[model samples]
Target: MRKLLFEMAYDGSRYHGYQVQQNALSVAEVVQDAVEVVFKKREDIVGCSRTDAGVHASQYFFHMETALQIPPEAAVIALNNCLPGDIAMLSCTEIPPDKAADFHARYSVCWKEYVYKIWNSKVKNPFLQDRAYQVKYPVDAELLDRCAREFIGTHDFRGFCSAGAKPTENYTRTIYRAGVHREGDLIEFRVAGDGFLYNMVRIMVGTLLLAAEGKLKEGDVTRVLASLDREQAGITAPAAGLYLNWVSYTPFGEENPVK
Candidate 1:
């Protein structure tokens, strides 16, 4: 048996989420269908994260164990042919037998990066209808970018997480990068962290939007962080705007530079 790691990108507008569920369509379910077609049997796949519905991914990873022998490059093409247009299989690599025992799609992750896109303008963009959050009000990217710095460093991110999340032993997470920038009318909130609680990135982006709108003043983010009060944080931004941008496996390492 060999363990294969697959890289993919997908538009999540039509799926419930990444995980398979009963009575609902999901990315994993669709991908599994394609995998079954190629391998002539069901091979369970494990994904790196369970992204919320309508949340896209520019880079996602999954691993599966199969007895079939196929070159990694050829597997990519075969899978893509079976997959729908919204999902693209980018690459596949086999894990060495020695390393396969320790490798995991989720547990081995060192960090993940998420980005929230906002289309800030009075005019709605038909092209970005479901790709970005359309904020009619003017947003100050420079100010939000400065305020976003407060998210950097280790902290208990419970305040940024949504209520009713699955109970976890700890809420502490390390943020390596947090910043907001604008290109034309699109504002992007990019955050990188060792791990994130449920809806953490969306909440952070919403808090920054509040800062941009002058509803939250300078230093409010720090206050919210220290308070550890979820009520103190801003609203949870829409799922449509959030995208899993990057994932790193190297221990205590920066992400590889990519376009």
Candidate 2:
């Protein structure tokens, strides 16, 4: 009878993805069961994003309708106690009655941020084994930043998405923030946009890595975006290196701030 919104983070090393699949463990499935244990049976549970296998999330959201009369704050604590160690509930909110009736986790999203982590070191990093990409080659952070900024504005990102993914006529997306940073051996590629196609962030990181290493082909970044060809881009970065860093929703009645 009421909708509850919860933000969470999960280590995607084990589950298949966010959504549930037959014969596969999933983050949503675990959370859904935990919520059922704490609350009355839910009409449905919905997540904000559909992450690929081996991908991690530092921040995520889900909303569900249930008949339980428990407070949102109380539900958060109870759900965390029931969920796995890798997944933790950050907070819980009760959507306004007016919005609850119409709100959707996926369709209402305004923007999302994805981060690709790379440990640029000759030696392997034990701490970040499955959490980040360990590259033996030398990657200049300045070069990466320069190349990354090229993708800051809106463009057709068809080349940055996975070739195997479903087709879409609208390949254009607006990037709000795009940058690369380095600290010691840790290199982070951060990108925030109105939305993204499947595997778009990973492909962009792969192309940026080539530019950082001075291996990018002529007219790569811009030409690739215009060509709308997946093969023109670099390799698909490993899923383990990608993270759903953050998500933001547009206020009711306002359009997505695409820029």
Clashing pairs in 1: none
Worst 10 residues of 1 by lDDT: 250-259
Residue 82 CA displacement from its true place in model 2, Å: 0.7
lDDT of each: 0.91, 0.85
Off by over 4 Å in 1: 252-259
Q: RMSD per prediction, one decimal?
A: 1.8, 3.0
How many clashing residue pairs, candidate 2? 0
TM-score of each: 0.97, 0.93
lDDT string for model 2 (1-259, tens) is 7877889999999989888889999998899889878975645788898998889999998888887789888888999999999999998888888878777777878889899999999997788977999889888887788778888788988888887888888989999888899999999999999999988999998898778667774346877688878887888999989999988887423565211
Q: Count of backbone clashes for each model?
A: 0, 0
Q: Write the per-residue lDDT of candidate 1 for residues 195-233, one digit (tens) a residue.
A: 999999999988887897788987889999998898889
Cα error, candidate 1, residue 167 (Å): 1.7
